[model samples]
Target: MRMSEKRAKMVMSQFKFLFFVLNTTGLYVSHESRDASLGFMVQRIRQMKFVGSVALLAFGHRLTASGFTTSPHLSPCSQIQRQFGHSITNPTRFEASVTQRSLSTKPLEFPENPSPFSTIKNGILTLHHRLRNEEVLQWRALAFSFFSSLFLFRHAIDVKLASLWTFLTTSSSLIPRIFRTDSYEWVLAVSAFFFYIHFFWYADVSVRKASEQGKVHPWRKYRLQDRFEADKHRRSVELKLRRNGEIPSQNELVKNYSEVTKQTGWNWKAWTCEVWVYVVPLLTWDILSPRRHRRLAAFGAPTTIQVLRDITCGLLLYDILFFTGHILMHKIPLIYRTIHAKHHQEPEVRAGDVVRLSMVEEVLEVGFSIIALNLLGAHPISRSIYNLIITFLLTELHCGFDFPWTPQNVVPFGLATGSRRHHFHHRNGKHYYQKFFFHVDRLFGFFQKDDGSLHGDSVKPNPHIPPAWQ
Candidate 1:
């Protein structure tokens, strides 16, 4: 009797276990997603249920068989037991049919038109998916590096170097310049010619920044217009500004500077964007500006013909180096991905974007320029002139202003690579590797020809319209 009761209790526990297993199976089936398909989940749940049912059947069958064998005649307890066991054991015989029926049921389908909220949810999901991509992760890493660099510059330079720089400036700035070289003649000549380039650089950068912020003043602004006429439109605007020539008074000048300071601070950006761009080339020039140490660089002045000849020769040499190096940087995936990509990141060129290069590329280009000038054995006067022209050309190309009388357009169709073409090259880096001239670019089939057929004065980008350069 104790054996029978124990067997009966054991069967009851098996039924309870089966109940828990079936409930858990249903719970698992409830959850579904793109990853967890309905068909797959349902199949898994069915398999669990089938196994649980089989275990329950085996236990109940053994319990019922023992009760029936112990009784000689039919008893109420035995009859009830037998019936209960039949219900429990019957599932094993028919479970295959039940499983087949469940499996045959169609998987759920998503609604044809998702709700607005669902559409937004999908969009967000898609964006999240894309954000997880390798390229996006790389961008995130790059962004992190940039922000961390900014933090260091903001704290380290502003707190540490600024104090030292301030003290040095306070003491005697001229002393440092004088001490850099032995002769005062070198100082005077370098300052006399370099002043023009430095002044232009500072002014152009300040003006460009001011124009972007919509700061109106007396001077002609390089503003982006939504609608404009032909190339003549830019020329007409400039001509009108020149004809009027409304000079700002002292009060206006102070206010203009104040506005500029508000938009742009003399912080890390001013150093990185404005000062460092020209400073690198200047440092390079000091070493290679006048290689022969001739009297012309010290006391005497270079004649017009000498300046022109030096300019022509220096340009040819530098152009070859720049063009070849640029093409190589593009052609080599490793170099482009590592270094040149930094500069191309700013496609919409600004005055400061002219020298927006990696330290490696910046140093390389500077080397190219200074070496070319040294190889030509240029005088300081001619060297300065070459530097001035190159600096002006680069700055103007990046100024994002197109005028009919711009130096590139002023030079003629097939000669110089104009601001328009250079801007387009920035937009798409595949073509126009030559900076100043078209001779090499044309020969290399990388030139974008200005046939006078295409004309548009609108500098502002239209989001809906694709770039023609691309």
Candidate 2:
């Protein structure tokens, strides 16, 4: 009887364990399926909303036109009389003139049988017609590219979700398996790939778009004096060289120091090197880091304190590292000439020109920031947000257009280094090396004021400096 009781107990325990396993598995599958269904529903709802809005707008326009056509055409005096329910026996000259003017200005004519669907159909046709235009098509392509890049970065959200799921499932383990499935890894890899492609491709597209639209940089006029100063300096150097009986090379003497007005397009070789040397290493490090998962878990839905901590830590660390790297790149002549100067090739900076850095410069500037943030144990979501903030700032700085409504204009302090300041840096590389904030530049006396003038002692121009160095 004792043996039988022990056997029954063991059997019962085994059944309980089996049931637990089965229940957990079912829950996981159900949760995943539910999430997928929700995403599909959300997408469908957005499409419906867009269609409904378009339809409503078309209907509203049609109704407005019909209302105007059908409304009673009353003279100014008659309208007053009707409102008061009294007839005017005789009108003064002014009243008669006003009545005649009102009568002559007839309401627009409309079709007797106006089709409500006509406006909708016409709107659709007009959309199609616009899409058919080459310029419109190019704009659409650029917009698609920009949004696609953003969408790629959005996979980071998925990675966060996966990390959360993994943490929940494997909480007992010492190191959680955030990327348990092959799909998760692939998503990250693809995200990295798209990021590099976007960095390389989008700048050129943006430049082309800007050119087509005839949208000049808001601060471009400020650059006129700088250009004149540069030109004057160049002429003085050439004349001095000639007076010394040292003939400068024809190429050197006739060098164009003006900011580039046209798109320089892509440097395929540099881009390929950037992908292999910088992007690959960064992505690999990301894949290998378990801390990424921890960050995601901690920051997924942070409290107010956590939010502040992450932002503060991320900004300070990134700024210190990036500013240091930037200054070094400028101070080191060989690095500036061979590496940093690649970025300065386009003196006339555009939205797409932000990522146009040499492999080494890119690694030092962007890579260091990311690595330092990760090392600081920032939440994965915070790191992602930091990257986004950096991207927006850099893009806007290089974008040339300083719209009054931009964050830099609104904030006007802290990390909101205005586009004009950055443009000054691009125009004169000897000044403004700070990335996130202006204090570093101010501290180092390299700060360029809003008026495109340097704050500190001006550096003498080197005649031998390469054109790209500017």
Candidate-wise lDDT, in order: 0.54, 0.52
Model 1 Cα displacement at 172 (Å)?
A: 20
lDDT tens readout by residue for model 2, 1-470: 12243453454355346434533443333333334434443333334434443443343344344442222675322332343222122212222333344433432221233346987898989877876774434455565676566456655655565566557445765334434332243244335434644653554454445535665433332232233344555667688899999987777665754444444454455445544665577557666763444434454443334434676677767777887877887889987898788888876565556667766776666566657776777654455455555556665666655444444444423345666667667767767676657677777677644442232212211112224323
Model 1 clash pairs? none
Candidate number of the best TM-score: 2
Q: What lDDT tens digits, residue by residue, belong to model 1 across residues 63-127?
A: 55555334467642444346454434453323343344454343243223465899999998987
What's the C-alpha lDDT at position 390 in model 1? 74
The Cα error of candidate 1 at residue 428, in Å, is 1.6
Who wins the lDDT comparison?
1
Task: Evaluate candidate 2 by giving its C-alpha RMSD to the native, one decimal.
Answer: 26.8
RMSD of each: 24.4, 26.8
Window of ten residues with lowest summed lDDT in model 1: 461-470
